[model samples]
Target: MKKNVFYVLMLFFVFTACNREDMQNNPGNIEVVQKDPLTAKEINEKINETIKTKGRFSWKESSDHFIWSTIFQGNKIASIGFGSSFDRNLDSNNKAIEAEILKVIEQYEGKTERILLSSDQYLNQIDVAIEKQETVIALRKMKNIRYLEPADYRYFENEQKLGKSSSGSSGCGFESTALSASDYTTVTPNAKAPWSFTKHNIINAWSYSSGAGVTIGVIDSGVSPEQTLLGSSFNNGLSSGRTISKNGVYVDSIWPWSTGYDGPNDQCGHGTSMASAAAAPRNNQGQPVGVAYNSNLVTYRAASNVVLDGYHEQNGVKIAFTELGNNNNVKIISMSMGHIFSVGKIEDGVKYAYSKGKLIFCAGGTSTSFTNFVGVIFPAWMSETQAITGVKENTSNQKCDVCHSGAEIDFTYQMERASGNSIPVLSYYNGQTDYVGGSSVATASTAGIAALVWSKNPTWTRDQVLNKMRQSATYYPTPNSDYGYGNINVLQAVQ
Candidate 1:
C-alpha cells in the first residue's frame, strides 16, 4: 500500500512538471500564444472557429490599416499626405498653391511641414491622423480646393500584394539584372558579375562603352547604400557638365532616404533590385552587376509603402521628376510601377522629364486580363514614356511567354525568376527576402541597355538613343502584341 502511494505521488509530480512546462511555453489556450499576424491558412481557421463557436471567439488584434509590410520602429505617425489642387494650373503658381494648401490643411493639421519647390509648388510632409479622404472631400467644398489628396503613399505588403511563392512556376519575379546600387561612399567586396551580362549581350555592349557620364534615377521603394561594386564610384557618377538644371535648380545626385529613415533604406527590397537593373557595377566575380555599371544610381522614394493608390498624391512624385528632369546629369529615369488609375500627374511627370531630354522607362504590368480586358496600365500608357513589357525567354533563341507584353509597350525585355528560394537576377537588397520578374524589372533591364548605348555615344540626343533602342529591339512578330518591338539586343543596339 505504501509503494502504491509512492507511485501515485511520482505520477502526480510528473504531471505537475509537464503542466508547468506547458504553461510556461505553450498554454492550453492556443489563441493566447499567437503573436504574429495570421497567415491565409490561420485566418481561415480563425473565421471557421468563430463561426463554429457562434461568435464565442473574439478577435485578438485589430487595426484599421493593415500592417502589410515591415513594421518600422518608433512612434507610428497618425497620418501622412501629399499636395495637390483643384486647379491643374496650380503648378504655374507654386507659391500660391502652397499658401492655399496651408490654409486648407489648417483645419485638420497636426504637424505641418512642407518643402516648397522653386516651382513654388510645395509637397506637404505635414501629417494628420484624421480621415484624409473625407477631409479632402470636405476641403473640396471650399472654393479653389478641388484636390487635396494625402501625400503619404501606402502599398499592400509584398506578401499581401504578391503572395509569397515557393513554386517557381507561380508568383512575380522583379528582374533587377542591373538594378543600380546606392551612391557609394565606400565599398570593399569585389562585385561578382552574374551570367545575366552575357545573357542579354550586356557583355558585348560593355566592349563598346559602359555608362560613364550618366546618372539614372530609380523611383520605387528605396535603396541600400553599402554595395560593394556600386560603392566603387560614388560622387564621381555625376555629369559635371550638367550637374545643375538649366533653370539653375540643383537636385542631389543621390536622394537615398525613403519613408522616414534618413540615408539609404529599402524596406520592400524592390527599389534596390530596380536600381541594380539600372546600373550595378562590374566586380571581380561580377556575381551581381548592373547594366550601367559605370553610371550613378539616384534613388527616389515616391511611396512610403507599396500601395500606389493610383498616385492621387502626385506631389512627391512630381518633385522626383522635377529633380531628375531639371538635372541634366540624370539622363535616364526608370519607373517600374503601374496602376489602373487614369492619366494624372504621372503622365505630366513623364512628359516633363522627357522634355528635359531624359529617357524614361516604365513597367508594363503583369495582369494578363489587363492586357485583354481594360488596357495597358498607366503611366506606361503615356506616349512620352517608353513602356517596357516582360518576356520569359531563357535564351535569345527561345520563344518566350508574352507575359506582360502589349501593343502599347515600346520594347520587350527578358525577365527572370527562380522556383523555390532562389533569386536569379544579379541583384542587391536590404530586406531579408527578395522577389523578381515584372514589367518593372524588364524596364530597368532595357534602361540598362539604353545606358550602355548612350555611354558609347555620349553626345547622342535622347531621341536618337530611343530610336536606336526601338530599331535594335529583337522581333517577335510585326502585328503581334505578345512581344512589342522584341527583346532588346544590346549587341545590336550598340553595333
Candidate 2:
C-alpha cells in the first residue's frame, strides 16, 4: 500500500513538472503564471489560477476530477471549472458539469493532433473511434476540447441540412464539349477554345501578360486536358506543356480527385471557360493576355451532378476541393458553380483554406435562379468570411459600391450580355438546352481577375487581397444590390 502511494505521488510530481514545462512554452498569457507546477491532484489549483489569471479563459476546481467546465464573456472563453471524472455515478452533478464543460471545449476544438494525420494515416484509428462513436462532434461537447466560432456554429447548422438535401451520388454524366464560340473568342491562328486570348480582351490579355509563371487551381466541372488553349497553360511560361495530375489530397498530387468524366473533359464548359479566363495562351502572337499568362494551372474536379430540382450537385465537388486545398502549393481555388440552399458545414472547407492562408473565389448566384437577396450561395456563402461576391454589367459606363450597401456588394466585373437577336451559343445539357448567363459568367470574370491579382502579389493573403479590392474600389458609383462593389480593375489591383 505504501509503495502504491509512493508511485502515485511520483506520477503526480512528474505530471506537475510536465505542466510547468508546458506553461513555459505556452503561457496561456491571460495572466501572469508564476513558477509553479500542476499536479494531478492539484489540477483544481491550476483551474483556480486560470480563473484569477488575466487571460480570456478562467477555471476552477470542482467536486469530481478529470473534467473541466469553461466560462465565457460574449463568445470569449472567460473561465474554466475542473473535476475528477466525467462519470455521472462518480459525480452526481456530472450531467450539469458536462454541459458547461462542453461549451469551453467547443472554443478550442479545431483539427486535433489525433485527426491531423494523413488521410490513410490512422484511418483505422479514426474508424475505431467512429465505431466507439467518439466523434469530433462529441469531443467538441467535452470540457477538454476548445472553442467553436460563430462561423463554426453556422457550419454546424449547414451540415445538418446536408443530411436532408444530399443524395449519395457523384455528379457524373456531364455532356462533354470542345471550347466553342460561347467558351472563347478566336484569338490565335485556329483557336476555337472558349478562352482564346485574342477574342476576349480581358481574359486573352491576362493569358500572355498576366498569371505568368504562376500556378492556379480550378475546382469546377472537369476541364479537358487536350484543349489547344489550355494545353500549355500550366507549362512553365514556355509555349506549351502540362502539369501531371496526381490523385489525392497532398500538394504533390497534381489533381486532387480521380480523372472523372470532367477531367480534362469540361463537359459542362464551366471549368474550361473559367480556365480560359485565368490563363488562355495568346496564340494570336499579339497581347491578348491573361492575368497570369505564364502561370501554371492545377485542376481539381470535386462537384458532381445528379437530378435535383434547380440544384447543380456541387457539394461533393466543394468537399473534394477542400481536401486538395490542404496542400500548401494550392493557394487559390476558383469555383464557378454552387447550390442555392446554404450548406452550413460547407463553410468548414472555406475555414480550412482560410487557416492555410488560401484564397477562394466562387461565383455568386445566377440572376435567373432566384430572387432571395439574402443568404449567400455555396462556397461563396460558405466562405462568408473570405468570399468576393460578383457583380456585372453589359454597359460600359459602369461602377460598383459594396461598402455603403455592404449587404450586397463584394466586387463587380464586366459581362457580355447574350444578344436576343443573335443566335446564342448552343450548350447542351441532358438532352435539353438553355442559355447560361448571369453570375456564372461574372464569377468566371472575377476568378480571372483574382488570378491576375494573385500573380501580381503572390505574397498577399486572402484577407489582404479582399481588403485591397474593397478599399480600392471606385465606390462613389453608388453601390447597387446587383453590382455589390464596383468593377474589378486588374491594373488598379496590381498598383
Index of the highest-lDDT prediction? 1
Note the clash tally of each candidate: 36, 67
Full-model lDDT for every candidate: 0.50, 0.40
Candidate 1: stretches off by over 4 Å? 1-196, 232-262, 310-315, 367-375, 394-403, 417-435, 476-479
Distance (Å) between predicted and true CA of 413, model 1?
1.2
Q: Lowest summed-lDDT stretch of 10 residues in model 2?
A: 122-131
Candidate 2 ranges with C-alpha deviation above 4 Å: 1-209, 225-228, 232-267, 284-291, 306-315, 367-375, 382-408, 418-436, 476-482
- RMSD values for the candidates in order, in angstroms, are 19.4, 15.0
Q: Which candidate number has the best TM-score?
A: 1
lDDT of 1 by residue, 1-495 (tens): 999999999999998887753331222212322233334344334433543454222221222122211111111212222345322344454445456545544444333554221222233223332332223333333443322222222222222344532223222233343333331112224443333455567666766767777777877756645443333432232211212111111122222122332234544556666766666555444345567777766777664332343222243455577677767678888877655333234445666677678888887665432123223556776778887876554533222232344567777665642321112344343212233556666788788888888887888998989878777766633524645677777888888
Q: Cα miss at 262, model 2 (Å)?
A: 9.4
Model 2 C-alpha lDDT per residue in residues 238-289, reported as the tens digit of each score: 3354342423221211222222232335544555545555555544432223
